[model samples]
Target: MTRESGRYKGKRVIQGGRAQVRTVLYMAMMSAMQCNPVFKATFRHLVKAGKPKKVAIIACVRKMVVILNSMLRDGVMWDANTAKN
Candidate 1:
Protein backbone atom coordinates (compact mmCIF):
# COMPACT_ATOMS: atom_id res chain seq x y z
CA MET A 1 0.00 0.00 0.00
CA THR A 2 1.10 3.55 -0.71
CA ARG A 3 1.08 6.29 1.92
CA GLU A 4 0.41 9.84 0.85
CA SER A 5 1.31 13.00 2.71
CA GLY A 6 0.67 16.56 1.62
CA ARG A 7 -0.53 20.00 2.60
CA TYR A 8 -3.67 21.83 1.73
CA LYS A 9 -3.69 25.56 2.42
CA GLY A 10 -0.78 25.12 4.81
CA LYS A 11 -2.50 22.33 6.71
CA ARG A 12 -1.01 18.85 6.64
CA VAL A 13 -3.07 16.09 5.09
CA ILE A 14 -2.31 12.41 5.42
CA GLN A 15 -4.23 9.95 3.32
CA GLY A 16 -4.14 6.41 1.92
CA GLY A 17 -5.16 3.52 4.15
CA ARG A 18 -8.12 1.31 4.90
CA ALA A 19 -10.98 3.26 6.40
CA GLN A 20 -11.63 0.56 8.97
CA VAL A 21 -8.02 0.51 10.10
CA ARG A 22 -7.97 4.27 10.26
CA THR A 23 -11.04 4.27 12.45
CA VAL A 24 -9.52 1.75 14.80
CA LEU A 25 -6.24 3.64 15.02
CA TYR A 26 -8.06 6.86 15.81
CA MET A 27 -10.00 5.16 18.59
CA ALA A 28 -6.81 3.67 19.98
CA MET A 29 -5.15 7.06 19.80
CA MET A 30 -7.89 8.60 21.85
CA SER A 31 -7.33 5.99 24.53
CA ALA A 32 -3.58 6.43 24.33
CA MET A 33 -4.00 10.14 24.89
CA GLN A 34 -5.58 9.37 28.22
CA CYS A 35 -3.61 6.34 29.42
CA ASN A 36 -0.36 5.98 27.49
CA PRO A 37 2.38 8.23 28.75
CA VAL A 38 4.74 7.31 25.92
CA PHE A 39 2.17 8.13 23.32
CA LYS A 40 1.19 11.30 25.15
CA ALA A 41 4.80 12.43 25.25
CA THR A 42 5.27 11.59 21.58
CA PHE A 43 2.25 13.67 20.61
CA ARG A 44 3.37 16.58 22.74
CA HIS A 45 6.91 16.42 21.40
CA LEU A 46 5.74 16.45 17.82
CA VAL A 47 3.41 19.35 18.39
CA LYS A 48 6.12 21.25 20.25
CA ALA A 49 8.39 20.65 17.28
CA GLY A 50 5.89 22.57 15.12
CA LYS A 51 3.78 19.71 13.85
CA PRO A 52 0.02 20.12 13.80
CA LYS A 53 -2.05 18.56 16.56
CA LYS A 54 -3.66 16.07 14.23
CA VAL A 55 -0.28 15.22 12.76
CA ALA A 56 1.16 14.59 16.22
CA ILE A 57 -1.78 12.38 17.12
CA ILE A 58 -1.31 10.45 13.92
CA ALA A 59 2.37 9.97 14.74
CA CYS A 60 1.44 8.59 18.13
CA VAL A 61 -1.02 6.21 16.52
CA ARG A 62 1.67 4.98 14.16
CA LYS A 63 4.02 4.49 17.08
CA MET A 64 1.34 2.57 18.97
CA VAL A 65 0.84 0.22 16.04
CA VAL A 66 4.55 -0.41 15.72
CA ILE A 67 4.91 -1.12 19.42
CA LEU A 68 1.96 -3.47 19.42
CA ASN A 69 3.26 -5.34 16.38
CA SER A 70 6.69 -5.81 17.90
CA MET A 71 5.19 -7.01 21.17
CA LEU A 72 3.16 -9.64 19.32
CA ARG A 73 6.08 -10.70 17.10
CA ASP A 74 8.40 -11.15 20.08
CA GLY A 75 5.74 -12.67 22.33
CA VAL A 76 6.49 -10.13 25.02
CA MET A 77 4.47 -7.95 27.30
CA TRP A 78 4.41 -4.16 27.07
CA ASP A 79 7.26 -2.40 28.78
CA ALA A 80 7.13 1.37 29.04
CA ASN A 81 10.86 1.82 29.36
CA THR A 82 11.60 -0.31 26.32
CA ALA A 83 8.91 1.41 24.34
CA LYS A 84 10.46 4.79 25.00
CA ASN A 85 13.52 3.67 23.16
Candidate 2:
Protein backbone atom coordinates (compact mmCIF):
# COMPACT_ATOMS: atom_id res chain seq x y z
CA MET A 1 0.00 0.00 0.00
CA THR A 2 1.07 3.59 -0.51
CA ARG A 3 0.24 5.02 2.88
CA GLU A 4 0.07 3.56 6.38
CA SER A 5 -0.43 -0.17 6.65
CA GLY A 6 -3.24 0.28 9.14
CA ARG A 7 -5.13 2.31 6.58
CA TYR A 8 -4.19 0.16 3.63
CA LYS A 9 -4.14 -3.41 4.82
CA GLY A 10 -6.88 -5.62 3.37
CA LYS A 11 -7.90 -2.76 1.09
CA ARG A 12 -4.86 -2.39 -1.12
CA VAL A 13 -4.79 -4.96 -3.90
CA ILE A 14 -7.88 -6.12 -5.70
CA GLN A 15 -8.76 -9.76 -5.08
CA GLY A 16 -11.01 -10.74 -7.95
CA GLY A 17 -9.75 -13.12 -10.59
CA ARG A 18 -9.75 -16.71 -11.74
CA ALA A 19 -7.68 -18.81 -9.37
CA GLN A 20 -5.88 -20.63 -12.18
CA VAL A 21 -4.79 -17.48 -13.94
CA ARG A 22 -3.71 -15.88 -10.70
CA THR A 23 -1.56 -18.86 -9.82
CA VAL A 24 0.09 -18.92 -13.22
CA LEU A 25 0.73 -15.18 -13.14
CA TYR A 26 2.21 -15.42 -9.67
CA MET A 27 4.58 -18.17 -10.72
CA ALA A 28 5.56 -16.38 -13.91
CA MET A 29 6.20 -13.14 -12.03
CA MET A 30 8.36 -14.95 -9.50
CA SER A 31 10.42 -16.47 -12.29
CA ALA A 32 10.65 -13.17 -14.11
CA MET A 33 11.85 -11.39 -10.96
CA GLN A 34 14.61 -13.94 -10.75
CA CYS A 35 15.81 -13.82 -14.35
CA ASN A 36 14.30 -10.85 -16.16
CA PRO A 37 16.42 -7.73 -15.86
CA VAL A 38 13.37 -5.46 -15.65
CA PHE A 39 11.66 -7.30 -12.85
CA LYS A 40 14.92 -8.08 -11.09
CA ALA A 41 15.87 -4.45 -10.87
CA THR A 42 12.38 -3.53 -9.64
CA PHE A 43 12.45 -6.19 -6.94
CA ARG A 44 15.92 -5.12 -5.86
CA HIS A 45 14.87 -1.50 -5.65
CA LEU A 46 11.74 -2.25 -3.65
CA VAL A 47 13.66 -4.34 -1.14
CA LYS A 48 16.37 -1.72 -0.87
CA ALA A 49 13.67 0.85 -0.24
CA GLY A 50 12.44 -1.17 2.76
CA LYS A 51 9.51 -3.02 1.23
CA PRO A 52 8.93 -6.57 2.44
CA LYS A 53 9.79 -9.22 -0.15
CA LYS A 54 6.21 -10.42 -0.44
CA VAL A 55 4.95 -6.90 -1.02
CA ALA A 56 7.53 -6.35 -3.72
CA ILE A 57 6.62 -9.62 -5.37
CA ILE A 58 2.94 -8.73 -5.39
CA ALA A 59 3.70 -5.32 -6.84
CA CYS A 60 5.69 -6.92 -9.63
CA VAL A 61 2.90 -9.36 -10.31
CA ARG A 62 0.42 -6.51 -10.53
CA LYS A 63 2.68 -4.75 -12.99
CA MET A 64 2.88 -7.87 -15.10
CA VAL A 65 -0.90 -8.09 -15.11
CA VAL A 66 -1.21 -4.53 -16.34
CA ILE A 67 1.41 -5.05 -19.00
CA LEU A 68 -0.24 -8.23 -20.17
CA ASN A 69 -3.62 -6.55 -20.36
CA SER A 70 -2.24 -3.65 -22.37
CA MET A 71 -0.50 -5.99 -24.77
CA LEU A 72 -3.67 -7.96 -25.31
CA ARG A 73 -5.74 -4.84 -25.83
CA ASP A 74 -3.30 -3.39 -28.36
CA GLY A 75 -2.60 -6.69 -30.07
CA VAL A 76 1.08 -6.00 -29.68
CA MET A 77 3.84 -8.51 -29.16
CA TRP A 78 5.57 -8.64 -25.81
CA ASP A 79 8.55 -6.36 -25.70
CA ALA A 80 10.61 -5.81 -22.57
CA ASN A 81 11.30 -2.18 -23.39
CA THR A 82 7.67 -1.38 -23.98
CA ALA A 83 6.61 -3.14 -20.82
CA LYS A 84 9.22 -1.29 -18.82
CA ASN A 85 7.85 2.01 -20.01
Candidate 3:
Protein backbone atom coordinates (compact mmCIF):
# COMPACT_ATOMS: atom_id res chain seq x y z
CA MET A 1 0.00 0.00 0.00
CA THR A 2 1.04 3.58 -0.57
CA ARG A 3 0.38 6.59 1.59
CA GLU A 4 -0.45 9.97 0.17
CA SER A 5 -1.59 13.26 1.50
CA GLY A 6 -5.33 13.39 1.65
CA ARG A 7 -7.38 16.40 0.61
CA TYR A 8 -7.47 17.48 4.20
CA LYS A 9 -4.12 18.71 5.37
CA GLY A 10 -2.31 16.50 7.92
CA LYS A 11 -4.41 13.50 6.96
CA ARG A 12 -2.87 10.58 5.12
CA VAL A 13 -4.67 8.29 2.72
CA ILE A 14 -3.90 4.67 2.06
CA GLN A 15 -4.08 3.88 -1.63
CA GLY A 16 -3.50 0.75 -3.63
CA GLY A 17 -6.33 -1.72 -3.50
CA ARG A 18 -9.57 -2.05 -5.40
CA ALA A 19 -12.02 0.37 -3.85
CA GLN A 20 -14.72 -2.24 -3.29
CA VAL A 21 -12.37 -4.60 -1.49
CA ARG A 22 -10.90 -1.80 0.54
CA THR A 23 -14.35 -0.62 1.49
CA VAL A 24 -15.37 -4.10 2.61
CA LEU A 25 -12.20 -4.50 4.64
CA TYR A 26 -12.76 -1.15 6.29
CA MET A 27 -16.25 -2.27 7.25
CA ALA A 28 -14.92 -5.51 8.70
CA MET A 29 -12.32 -3.53 10.60
CA MET A 30 -14.99 -1.44 12.23
CA SER A 31 -16.55 -4.59 13.65
CA ALA A 32 -13.19 -6.10 14.52
CA MET A 33 -12.26 -3.00 16.42
CA GLN A 34 -15.35 -3.42 18.59
CA CYS A 35 -15.16 -7.13 19.37
CA ASN A 36 -12.04 -8.89 18.20
CA PRO A 37 -9.47 -9.08 20.94
CA VAL A 38 -6.54 -9.92 18.67
CA PHE A 39 -7.38 -7.14 16.29
CA LYS A 40 -7.88 -4.68 19.11
CA ALA A 41 -4.54 -5.61 20.59
CA THR A 42 -2.85 -5.22 17.23
CA PHE A 43 -4.35 -1.79 16.74
CA ARG A 44 -3.37 -0.71 20.23
CA HIS A 45 0.16 -1.96 19.76
CA LEU A 46 0.59 0.00 16.55
CA VAL A 47 -0.80 3.19 18.02
CA LYS A 48 1.35 2.78 21.12
CA ALA A 49 4.31 2.52 18.78
CA GLY A 50 3.38 5.97 17.42
CA LYS A 51 1.62 4.95 14.25
CA PRO A 52 -1.36 7.09 13.25
CA LYS A 53 -4.79 5.69 14.09
CA LYS A 54 -5.73 5.29 10.46
CA VAL A 55 -2.44 3.61 9.72
CA ALA A 56 -2.95 1.22 12.59
CA ILE A 57 -6.45 0.45 11.39
CA ILE A 58 -5.22 -0.33 7.91
CA ALA A 59 -2.60 -2.63 9.38
CA CYS A 60 -5.35 -4.49 11.19
CA VAL A 61 -7.35 -4.73 8.02
CA ARG A 62 -4.39 -6.22 6.21
CA LYS A 63 -3.87 -8.62 9.06
CA MET A 64 -7.48 -9.72 8.93
CA VAL A 65 -7.23 -10.37 5.23
CA VAL A 66 -4.07 -12.39 5.69
CA ILE A 67 -5.57 -14.43 8.48
CA LEU A 68 -8.68 -15.12 6.46
CA ASN A 69 -6.67 -16.16 3.47
CA SER A 70 -4.54 -18.49 5.49
CA MET A 71 -7.56 -20.02 7.17
CA LEU A 72 -9.10 -20.72 3.81
CA ARG A 73 -5.95 -22.22 2.46
CA ASP A 74 -5.50 -24.45 5.47
CA GLY A 75 -9.16 -25.28 6.05
CA VAL A 76 -8.94 -24.11 9.61
CA MET A 77 -11.41 -22.27 11.78
CA TRP A 78 -10.77 -19.08 13.66
CA ASP A 79 -8.99 -19.52 16.96
CA ALA A 80 -8.37 -16.49 19.11
CA ASN A 81 -5.50 -17.97 21.08
CA THR A 82 -3.74 -19.18 17.96
CA ALA A 83 -4.31 -15.84 16.26
CA LYS A 84 -2.90 -13.95 19.22
CA ASN A 85 0.34 -15.85 18.95
Candidate 4:
Protein backbone atom coordinates (compact mmCIF):
# COMPACT_ATOMS: atom_id res chain seq x y z
CA MET A 1 0.00 0.00 0.00
CA THR A 2 1.20 3.43 -0.95
CA ARG A 3 0.47 6.44 1.23
CA GLU A 4 0.40 9.76 -0.55
CA SER A 5 1.79 12.81 1.21
CA GLY A 6 -0.33 15.05 -1.03
CA ARG A 7 1.24 18.27 -2.41
CA TYR A 8 4.89 19.27 -2.42
CA LYS A 9 4.69 20.28 1.21
CA GLY A 10 1.89 19.31 3.59
CA LYS A 11 1.34 18.05 7.13
CA ARG A 12 1.07 14.42 6.21
CA VAL A 13 4.34 12.50 6.30
CA ILE A 14 4.03 8.94 5.14
CA GLN A 15 6.24 6.48 7.01
CA GLY A 16 7.41 3.57 4.87
CA GLY A 17 5.70 0.50 6.35
CA ARG A 18 2.08 0.39 7.38
CA ALA A 19 2.79 -0.64 10.97
CA GLN A 20 5.74 1.68 11.24
CA VAL A 21 3.64 4.48 9.84
CA ARG A 22 1.02 3.97 12.50
CA THR A 23 3.64 4.01 15.22
CA VAL A 24 5.25 7.09 13.81
CA LEU A 25 1.89 8.81 13.48
CA TYR A 26 1.02 8.10 17.10
CA MET A 27 4.37 9.47 18.23
CA ALA A 28 3.96 12.51 16.01
CA MET A 29 0.55 13.13 17.51
CA MET A 30 2.01 12.95 20.99
CA SER A 31 4.70 15.43 20.01
CA ALA A 32 2.10 17.75 18.52
CA MET A 33 0.24 17.84 21.81
CA GLN A 34 3.40 19.18 23.42
CA CYS A 35 4.66 21.48 20.66
CA ASN A 36 1.58 22.62 18.75
CA PRO A 37 -0.36 25.31 20.56
CA VAL A 38 -3.71 24.34 19.10
CA PHE A 39 -3.25 20.70 19.87
CA LYS A 40 -1.96 21.51 23.32
CA ALA A 41 -5.04 23.57 24.07
CA THR A 42 -7.33 20.94 22.68
CA PHE A 43 -5.67 18.26 24.77
CA ARG A 44 -5.98 20.38 27.87
CA HIS A 45 -9.65 21.05 27.11
CA LEU A 46 -10.28 17.37 26.83
CA VAL A 47 -8.47 16.73 30.08
CA LYS A 48 -10.53 19.37 31.84
CA ALA A 49 -13.65 17.51 30.78
CA GLY A 50 -12.46 14.58 32.94
CA LYS A 51 -11.59 12.54 29.92
CA PRO A 52 -8.91 9.88 30.23
CA LYS A 53 -5.56 11.19 29.12
CA LYS A 54 -5.03 8.23 26.81
CA VAL A 55 -8.48 8.62 25.29
CA ALA A 56 -8.08 12.36 24.85
CA ILE A 57 -4.70 11.89 23.23
CA ILE A 58 -6.12 9.34 20.84
CA ALA A 59 -8.96 11.67 19.95
CA CYS A 60 -6.50 14.46 19.29
CA VAL A 61 -4.53 12.19 17.03
CA ARG A 62 -7.66 11.24 15.14
CA LYS A 63 -8.49 14.89 14.74
CA MET A 64 -5.06 15.48 13.33
CA VAL A 65 -5.60 12.76 10.73
CA VAL A 66 -8.90 14.30 9.72
CA ILE A 67 -7.37 17.73 9.44
CA LEU A 68 -4.58 16.38 7.31
CA ASN A 69 -7.13 14.67 5.10
CA SER A 70 -9.07 17.89 4.62
CA MET A 71 -5.92 19.80 3.79
CA LEU A 72 -4.88 17.21 1.23
CA ARG A 73 -8.33 17.13 -0.34
CA ASP A 74 -8.69 20.89 -0.57
CA GLY A 75 -5.07 21.77 -1.24
CA VAL A 76 -5.13 24.26 1.57
CA MET A 77 -2.24 25.54 3.65
CA TRP A 78 -1.95 24.53 7.29
CA ASP A 79 -3.39 27.09 9.64
CA ALA A 80 -3.55 26.10 13.29
CA ASN A 81 -6.34 28.52 14.10
CA THR A 82 -8.33 27.63 10.99
CA ALA A 83 -8.71 24.09 12.31
CA LYS A 84 -11.03 25.18 15.08
CA ASN A 85 -13.10 27.27 12.74
Per-prediction TM-score, please? Answer: 0.80, 0.73, 0.80, 0.72
Q: Assess each prediction's global lDDT (C-alpha) against the native.
A: 0.84, 0.83, 0.87, 0.83
- TM-score (C-alpha) between model 3 and the true structure: 0.80
Error of 3 at 48 (Å): 0.9
Steric overlap count per candidate:
0, 0, 0, 0
Cα deviation of 17, candidate 2, in Å: 5.9
- Tens digits of per-residue lDDT, candidate 4, 1-85, equal 3456446453333446578667787899889988899889989999999998887887898899999999999999999778874
User: Clashes in model 2: which pairs?
Assistant: none
Candidate 2 lDDT (Cα, whole model)? 0.83
Cα displacement (Å) at residue 67, model 4: 0.4
RMSD of each: 3.4, 4.4, 4.1, 11.4
Candidate 2 lDDT over residue span 6-83, tens digit each:
555553554666779878888998899878888898889899999998888988998888888998999999898887
For model 2, give the 10-residue run with minimal summed lDDT: 1-10
Top candidate, metric lDDT = 3
**Candidate 1 residue-wise lDDT, 29-84, digit = tens:** 98888898888888888989999788788788888889999999999999999999
lDDT computed for candidate 4: 0.83
TM-score of candidate 4 versus the correct structure, residues matched by position: 0.72
